[model samples]
Target: MAGPTLRTYKAGSIIYFIEDKGSDVFVLQKGRIILISNSLDSASEIKEDVQKGEFFGVKSALGAYPREETAQVLADSVVLVFTPVMFEAFCTKNPRLVLQMLKVFSGQLRKVHRKVREVLGETGQQENSVELLRTAESFYKMNLKDHANYAFKTFLKNYSTSNFATRGQSMLDMISRGQPYPVEMDSLETIIEKIRLGEMDVSQNAESTNFGDMQMNDVGSMEPPPLDDFSQPEDMHIPDMDDTGLSNDDGSGMMDIPDMDLPDMDIPDMDLPDYTPSMKKPPQMNVPQPSASKPALEGITQFYYDGVNEFSKQNWDVAIKRFEAALSINKFENDAEASFLEKSLFELGRTYMRKGDLTNGIGKLSDFVKKYPRNPNLKKAMAYIAEGYEKKGDKQRAMALYNKVVSMPPRDKESNYAKTQLDRLMK
Candidate 1:
């Protein structure tokens, strides 16, 4: 109600599909929908059914491109949408809502990042989806028609008995109505098989934890569907005229990205070499500035776009490459560039950390610190460096950095962060 205007789509209409970009949080007011994705060949279609009173499209377009899947109207549907601008305004108007939204963003982004890492083989698999699915069914007390399907049975045995069943079930519940399957069964099968193999490997190595106490007890059910208070059909209509200056309910038509919030970023400070008088001229500059490198810049921009695609698809390796390439081309401009760099470095470090190569992670963190000594994120970089050192069995060095972080002049977030790290180190 506080966000954007509402829109309605007839049944069978395609809302959006894989690779589309925009931020319009769709809230289903009526009718059913299907979330789907097709492989490159357009042969494989994975479908997930979304029910009424649910939200989709909100999570996928979080300032990223190439959405993971497509959404089709399964029936005459009514959806209330929120654009990023509208949502930001809502957050500004409501601090409580901001807190809740921040929590969701933090947890969801982290989860998606981890999933991308796992799927890209950048991180070792912890639990396979077969077990995840089985755990979901068991957590819901589902009785399968057949136990002969090894896939389904193993899913049950591992998921139902493991300590992570609750979390697994929650994921299923999110996708249960949203229909998150890909267009290709083969792709789905590939993912499934990977999970299965990963699970088997896990089983061979470690004892499964008991999940008897992992059940969620007091979670609140989702709120009822939002109701519109319009009194008449004509009330929704407006006088037709040229230059109406009206935007869609999603407000994407009015989209204009403001300067990025660099203060909130976790990045390093790098000294950008100023362009000399000669370098500023195309004829004299050696760095290939087609239009002073417009073509190369475009190529790098495309790479960043593709990286967003990969990031959305949970392909962390590919996404990281794209981001790295974009950084190489030209560091982003304004605060957006800073945010991108910070996020990229943090994620890159995280990817290495997840792979159990803390030494490499520490090196990356060190690079950030050396480059951006005055950056606010320098504090985070140092903290991560300390963590990396500790992970690499260099506790003495870790403690020294931790002490330095806490001893910084400003008694603000960085100082607090340093304090937290020092306390952790001491502990």
Candidate 2:
């Protein structure tokens, strides 16, 4: 049998499309390719970027089913294409490759089964044990404590006898105790050695004191000598005293000094002055007071109402400006303002669509979908996004969104319109 054929494709090349008939598996040798497909129920578009040394089209080719995706070359690329018989022969010689394919197939199957159950509103199906453990581990690694805690608890509950049960339980306990992942710490011996070295460094850098020829390690330890240890100087004289200690000239026990006369000077007195205060008061001045502040959401409501008025009048540009102004207001202090903000965003997207700006329209609606997931206008916004993508010639994405709308519960006007579009697009 001939080996696989190697082919090169330039950027913007389409290798295949959905529903195409082929039994050839491809392996990306270089550059990039994007596989665009929808979910099992066609409710969401799945874009898989094929990396180097990865296989694509294996399941569909091997199962002899129509191609489930459209493979478009994203860059100048080289690919190896193998027929089903050649691939089987190649896998027979490479058992590891077969094992890898089996793992991939099993994971894909599990995801499909999960999506099916979700679409059928069946909540009783048990989640895969390995996937649950992996999810918990991923969340833990990302430091999402709350999500990790929930995932770990669910895993432990469902897989009590699993090999990873002990690890899951330990992680749960750590999370409960609010302990982060363990970090490597220095040993006791290392810490003690560091302390000892630090003390030695301090001692080496300390200043010493000198007393005569002796050096003291610590200056604070020395004391001063007593004051009575010195004798009187030899040149100093002392007077001898009799029993009464009297001087002969005074005939008294005390010495007498001559009195000195002081001169007197003429002095003049001056008059002092005093004053009394008046009982007049100062004039009062007028000061302006600040006006009362407006409510936090004051301008937002007006802008939203103005935008709605313009939108109803089919003035797309003016409506967009008003909606943008409403969203530009920084303060959304309360739930009422927040609701208005959501409405403003949704209307802005609708205005863009009306103006024939599909890119901006799709962008704003997509933002609304993410930012206001629980908003009452979510389904309507999604339908508008689908309509935008349809107008932009992206039928795959449009169909996917339409399918999602149809799958959502409570068949309202939007869902009904989506179902009609989906049926038309399918036909």
Candidate 2's clash total is 0
Candidate 2 segments whose C-alpha is farther than 4 A from its true place: 1-295
lDDT, residue 116, model 1: 79
For model 2, how does the per-residue alpha-carbon lDDT over 104-158 read when each residue is reduced to its tens digit?
8899888888878788875425337756765785686578999999999999888
Predictions in order: lDDT: 0.46, 0.59
Determine which window of 10 residues in candidate 2 has minimal summed lDDT.
229-238
In the range 1-427, model 1's lDDT, one tens digit per residue, is 4657788899989988778886777778888889997754578988887767555776665666667778899899888777877766765887986677678789977887887777786523544654445443343333322322343345545656543333233334333433332111111122233235442122321111111111112112111111110000000001121111122122221112111111212222221111000000001112222122344424443444444345434455665565566556554344433334543454455434434446555666666556545444455556666666665556777777767767655444446656766787788
How many backbone clashes does every candidate have? 20, 0
Instruction: Judge candidate 1 at residue 166 and give its lDDT.
Output: 31
TM-score of each: 0.30, 0.31
